[model samples]
Target chain A: MKRNKKMIIAFITPALVTFLVMFVYPVIRTVIMSFFKVESLTASTSEWQFAGLDNYIGIWKTPIFRTSMINMGVIWLVGGVIVLSVSLLLAVILTSGVRFKSFFRAAIYLPNVISAVALAIMWIQYVFSKKYGMLTSFFRALGLDNLAKISWLDSDMKFWAMLIAFCFGAVGYYMLIFLSGIEQIPQDLFEAATIDGANKMGQFAHITLPLLKGVFKTNLTFWSINTMMFFVWSKMFSPVETEASTISPVVYMYNIVFGTKGVTQRDAGRGAAIGVTMALFVLIIFFIFNRVLKDDDLEY
Target chain B: MKKKVISAVLCTTMAVAMLAGCGSNGGAKSNSTSKATSAASSAAESTSAKSKSTEPAKAEGGKNLVYWSMWNETEPQAEVIKDAIEEYQTESGNTVTVEWKGRDISTIIQAALDAGETIDLFDEDYQRVGQQYASKCMDLEDMAKAADYETHSVEALPTALRGWAGSLKGIAYQPYTSGIFYNKAMFKEAGIEKEPATWTEFLDACKKLKDAGYAPLVQDDAYVLYSYGFQIARHLGQDGVVDLCKNGGWAESEGALAAAKEIQSLVESGYYSEYAPDAYPNNENEIGYENAAMIVNASWVPSEITNNTKCDIEWGMFNYPTVDGGKDPATVANVGAQAFAIPDNSKNGQAAFDLIMKITTGAFDQKMALDTQSIPADPTNEEWPEMIAGCKDAFNALTNVYDWNMGLNTDADLKTVIQDNLMKLFEGKMTAEEFIAAVDAASK
Candidate 1:
């Protein structure tokens, strides 16, 4: 027993030290700095104190923060559902004893290997350009040049366009995850279903999906987290002076803390308040989501 | 009793060791090399300079810096900066390790800023300058007033550039200047004789090009739209309007409204080539594939848009298409210079500052043009591509500053209002009048 205790201590020490130094220290520092107003960049060195929960209360009243929360939640739902559903469907289709399965698998998984910046550029340049985009050129070749030069990222369809690019780039990884889950299923169950005269569709609905519940839960949870971290993508995607779309909770927190291109005093307390609020909200959201989505346990 | 004894002993040893570690060693030849460079650069500026910035790094010696850049718009210039650093390291063996944050300074830059932490040196966006001033996050005056002040000559920067950096509160880097970049071949194909000198002719030319199966313009809607609106605002508010807009909500009221109307008309008229919203192009694209004959972009686009893409573009530039009877023909040509600042908490401040001064103010300009093929800051460089340098007068005629609110001017509520309601206008969810009302409501 004593030896086990020592072993556990040895294993846990590094992580514990890391958490205290990296995570705990920063959080405490940020929470404390969330108060006090910046006079000028170099003039202040003092760690300013709190002026009540003004930082926390103030963020709630700001429309930007509110909109970000709404948009982040929506992106989580929409991006998660679309990527998961489509990729899972593709994984199953390729795995259903089909010809050229390996080729199809490689093609499906190709995009995830490419960097997001590179993928984003390719989508803009060769794929969507009304002039040179293969898509636009095909239309022009058919003499429907009016459709050429259409701006995909304009206000009319900017969000959808961004969503499409993000989903398309991300589907490959999700497909592989779903494929692994599909592979782990017992072949005997499908055979049993066949003997009972259940069609392919019936076998899929009755056995495949129900049995893949654990994977789906894991996939959706991760997807939600990824979508929620949208700041960098949103800023990159927006035109100057226009608003950003990928402003996740993290982005909003960042903007509040560091300030933005052309506005406001640094409110560290408010930024911390936003961070605290987000963490708590994320927890609440996960709880509500699991409660709503959790079905009966599926035996292996 | 045993746990207490161990804890007490470990804490004392570790704490003492950490304190010692933070204090960098002074006994190195590399430190002497850095000191020598600082001395040589100082001698170049003046003989009688008394700035104490000549001192070696004081906070802690031989500090490690984690620097990130968004994305370097030009690969050649990126190469030049990289080579220069490598050269510096070879010459002095004092290295500041770099990590690219992103292509456009948005990725790691945003993360760093949001983290509310001190960074050693970074290519921060010009827009962040205003916020830094307001939030007291940056110190331009201090950055410009360093010890070797004479040699680096930061104080000698163009007033217009300095003013744009939000100099009063924080130090904002001077940004790229916006100009009109057009396809020369497209002009000939449309049978237009010369660059438009008046707004009527500009629109007529665009209309003709539209009819000739070419997009007259393309909207990136990703980075330059609101800036485009700011440029247009200069034209709409003629006759001392720049001053008027800065002093009051006259810009947001009448100025932003007019610009909004112009954007709507552009959308309705079908003169634009659109890219996807998420696209941040650091390289060649189909637009330069001769899609739209022209684009309104900053100084760096010359490097970013050419050489890589296989477009045989014969490019030419014009001033902001002449505004009607405008007092000043100059519309705002955005100047977004990313400034490198030393954080108050940085231990490597002196070394980083010395390096920054050497890199930005010296061979970096020539290196930039040669490496990236972009326009050079130093006018003396003969290597500049004719397309960019030949029409210098026309380009210089464009305004260089944003010329809006500063000094307690906060963009928080204003930016929020615009982001929310502006989308509706772009999405066909709101009209020009509605946008006007939205601005008015926001201002009040």
Candidate 2:
């Protein structure tokens, strides 16, 4: 027993110390920073002025920040629905003894393997390009001149365009998760269902979905976290400056913290406050998910 | 017991390795600093030995200058700088160690400065160096006097730096001005005899170009705010525009309304191209493709267009034309420059300043301007690149330099709102009244 304990301690010390230094320390510092008026990120604690909830209150009053929050909310809710449904649908189709399943899976997941920056550029420069864009060419080919004329990168359509591109890349990962969940449910249960007069749709609705509640919850949690850190796509869409249509909470936080072109003031305190807000949002969503999707004691 | 002993040994090794890694980094930094010092001393001795008889005054060898540049190694600017550094080392017996931080220097520079990093010299946007790092920068007034920089360099730049930071904060290099960079071939094709000097003449020029079956003006979405800012600045100078942005007087400012009405008329008259507010580089490329005649952009646009598309555009530039009853004259322009600064914490400030002078003046300045297709910093170097030769008169004639977006970008909160509405105005989606009202409400 002594030997085992020694071995465990010896193996875990490095990881524990790293975790404390790298992750825990920064988290604690950021949390404390949220309550202080820190102009520069490198400003010493001695220079920090205790602003209490001022940063939080001030950020909420900022119109651009408010716009960013609204944009994030829309991306989360709308993007979540589209991504989950499409990924789930693809998961079902792929796992239903489909042809060349590996090839199809690889094809769908290829974008996820590519860098988000490169992927975003491909979408912006080619897919959503005003002139000679894929969608414009497609629409024109089909004699949809009105649709062809629509500028997908314009302020009105940019958000949706970004969302669609983001969701397209995200579906593959969630689809894999759903695929695993579907594969895990015993073949005997499905065979019995088929024998009982439960058709494919009925089987999916009753057995597959009910059993996949845990996976759905997991995917939802992941989606919520990803949406909270929604930065790259938004940044890529508005490369030069943060646009109202594409600005997210993280992007807003980055701008205020690191100082973008137009942002004269760099308040790391407000950036920390935004970080804390996002963390709270993710935590609340996690709590809600846990409560709503309670995993039952089901015999596999 | 054996497994535990092995694991204990492994853990101890890991901890020791981590500590050693950190120690090595510290050691490396210390080593570099000492190396620089030793190199300076050795060079001093050698110079004294070699030049003692011929030039006793030049016997004191050069100091090592640590320069953190904003350009990557592959960039044209960096190549020119590298050549200059080599020449400087050969001529003055100075050692310059340059770290190519690229654009990320702006973000990391403050932190590095705060950390008391041994950065002898650095360069960034003049406004950023002047305003953001004002207290940290060494006032170059005495150094400029010693070097006779006032007589050698462009007067407007140093004057602009003084205005920016209330002192001579930085030495300007690679200076550029934002104005109407136009296709001269298109101008000739449209029967335009001369560049427009006033708003009415500019509009007439636009009409003729449009009548000649060419798009008169096209602006990228990224530069729409800048374009609008130039128009606003023409009406209300840079300070007035900044005041309007800071305060909630946009709806009340007659200048703001006039500027908006001018842009509105441009949109209404089809003076702007069909893709006026297209994404960056797209609308700029329209000028390169000879589809558009003019774009209100920086003097670097021709070079950028040429580099990107390899299209030969007969580029000509003119300052933003004077608006009717405008406070600012046609002499005022939005001029910006890259500048070198010696940080207050720098140990070898004089050495850094000397290196900066070497890079930014005389033959090197002309060389940099030609190689990089940038405007020469040294006034004495009048052999401007043919691509941007037309900018010389406009640049030299500038009585005032405006801030980016005419200081409309001063307020972070209103920046996006103002830009969005400006785009809407150019796209004919919103009227001038709506723009003013919208921006005013947002400011409040």
TM-score of chain A of each: 0.84, 0.97
B187 Cα displacement, candidate 1 (Å): 5.5
Docking class of 1: acceptable
Error of 2 at A200 (Å): 1.8
lDDT by residue (B198-280, candidate 1, tens digit) is: 66787888898888788787544444434334444455533233343234463355555666676667667776654322244
Per-candidate RMSD vs. true structure?
7.2, 3.5
Candidate 2's DockQ is 0.54
| Cα-based lDDT at residue B270, candidate 1 | 72
**Alpha-carbon lDDT, every model:** 0.58, 0.84
Indicate which candidate wins on DockQ.
2
Off by over 4 Å in 2: A4-11, A297-300, B1-5, B16-42, B45-65, B91-94
**lDDT tens digits by residue: candidate 1, A194-221:** 9999999998899999888878877876
Model 1 chain A — which ten-residue stretch has the worst lDDT? Answer: A36-45
